[model samples]
Target: PDFSHRLAEYAAALSTRLVDLRRTLAEQRPDTYLPDLATSLNNQSVRLAALGQTEQALQAITEAVDLYRTLAEQRPDTYLPDLATSLNNQ
Candidate 1:
């Protein structure tokens, strides 16, 4: 088995799941899931970017950044660093 390719496939699937989780958040149900999803998406985006899927990686990172930014606005001290990190990554 080609381990690298398999890893990319796994990262792609994780990105898709992150998108789904973001959509769920958009349905007006803001809860614990949003932050976790954003974190997961951010990590997956890094993997995808490393794997050469720049477009998808940016999309995922953008969404994660947005999510984190919103949370940061309500709690700057806690989430600002995370949002800054995401922005730096992009």
Candidate 2:
């Protein structure tokens, strides 16, 4: 249980960092790292869910799915798989 709790905490912290990085990259690079941010968030969500942080995990995955949806709209071949994966997680 302690290990699970620690893992959840770490996942939450990493999610926060990913959000900050996404915002910074968006401002500095403008459309260059959005996919990376989305992927990181998706992975973080899985980690969060594994440790029972359902609400936070859901929020993270939802954001990832939204990002993937937008990206897929522009290039389905590249981002549709991500969208599908996030949707499955949701």
Candidate 3:
């Protein structure tokens, strides 16, 4: 339980860092960073859900799903599965 709690905290921090990274990188390098942001968001959602932060979990997953949709549109073979996974998490 302690390990789970620690991991959840780490995930939340990682999510925040990814958002900050996106702000810095998205305009210039979306293809490089957006998927990382999406994955981070998805993980954040799962962690938030596990911690019983329902509204935050939904928000994170919704953002992830949106990013995944755009990524999937560009590279279906690579990102479609990720989109499906994020949707399943949602």
Candidate 4:
């Protein structure tokens, strides 16, 4: 149970970091970091889900889905499945 609690805590921290990363992405003048932040956010979402923090996972992944869907519309081959997976997790 300690491990589960620790995992939840870790997930919470990761979720917070993802939120910070999103903010950083928006605030950055250069767009080069956006994709990396998006990818990191996606990974954090998956980790939260794996930790059973479903609500946090859903929120993070929903953001990811939005990002991926936008990208997918521009280039389906690249981001469509990423979008689908995020949506499927819902």
Candidate 5:
């Protein structure tokens, strides 16, 4: 129980950070490092789900999958694997 609680807290914190990073990037240079951030968010979602934060995990991964899909469309060779992983996770 304690471990799961800690994991949920960590996932929430990480999700908040990712949101901040995305907002900052959008305000400063909208096209920069989005794919990388999305990948991080996807990984965080996986952690959240493992911790049993189902709704939050689904929301996070949904956003990540959308971003990955867009990235994969632009650069299939580079982002297809990431997109595939995110899809499988979802």
Candidate 6:
């Protein structure tokens, strides 16, 4: 139990760093990096959920869902499934 908690904590920290990096990249080249940022956010949500941080998890997934929604509008074929996944995650 202790090891699992520690692992979750470490994962959450790593996910936060990854999200920050992806967010910056996305800002620099939105067309190319938005999907990456969304993916990172989705992954971060999962890690946060594992740590039992429900509110933070919800916030991360909500942002991911919004990002996926915008992407889906551009390419539903590719992003609708992701949007659905993010919604489910939320």
Separately for all candidates shown, the number of backbone clashes (residues 3 or more apart, or on different chains) is 0, 0, 0, 0, 0, 0
- Better by lDDT, candidate 2 or 1: 2
Tell me which of candidates 1 and 5 scores higher on TM-score: 5
Inter-residue clash pairs, candidate 5: none
Q: Candidate 1 at 32: error in angstroms?
A: 2.1
Query: After superposition on all CA atoms, how large is the RMSD of candidate 2?
Result: 1.9
TM-scores for every predicted model? 0.76, 0.81, 0.80, 0.66, 0.78, 0.96
Q: Give me the overall lDDT of model 3.
A: 0.86
lDDT of 5: 0.81
User: Which candidate number has the best TM-score?
Assistant: 6
Which regions of candidate 6 deviate over 4 angstroms?
none
Over 16-76, each residue of candidate 6 has an lDDT whose tens digit, in order, gives 9999999999999999999999999999999998888989999999999999999999999
Q: Between candidates 2 and 6, which one is better according to TM-score? A: 6
RMSD of each: 2.3, 1.9, 2.3, 2.8, 2.2, 0.9
Q: Considering only N, C-alpha and C atoms within 3 Å, which residue pairs clash in candidate 3?
A: none
**Superior candidate under TM-score, 1 versus 4:** 1
Candidate structures ordered by TM-score, highest first = 6, 2, 3, 5, 1, 4
Error (Å) of candidate 4 at residue 79 is: 1.4
The numbered model that scores best in lDDT is: 6
**How well does candidate 2 match the true structure in TM-score terms?**
0.81
Once superposed on the true structure, which residue ranges of model 1 sit more than 4 Å away at CA?
A: 18-28
Between candidates 2 and 3, name the one with more favorable lDDT: 3
Worst 10 residues of 1 by lDDT: 25-34
Q: What local lDDT does model 1 show for residue 36?
A: 70
- Report the lDDT tens digits of candidate 3 across residue range 2-90: 99798888877777777767747876788788898888888888877877889989999999999999999999999999999999999
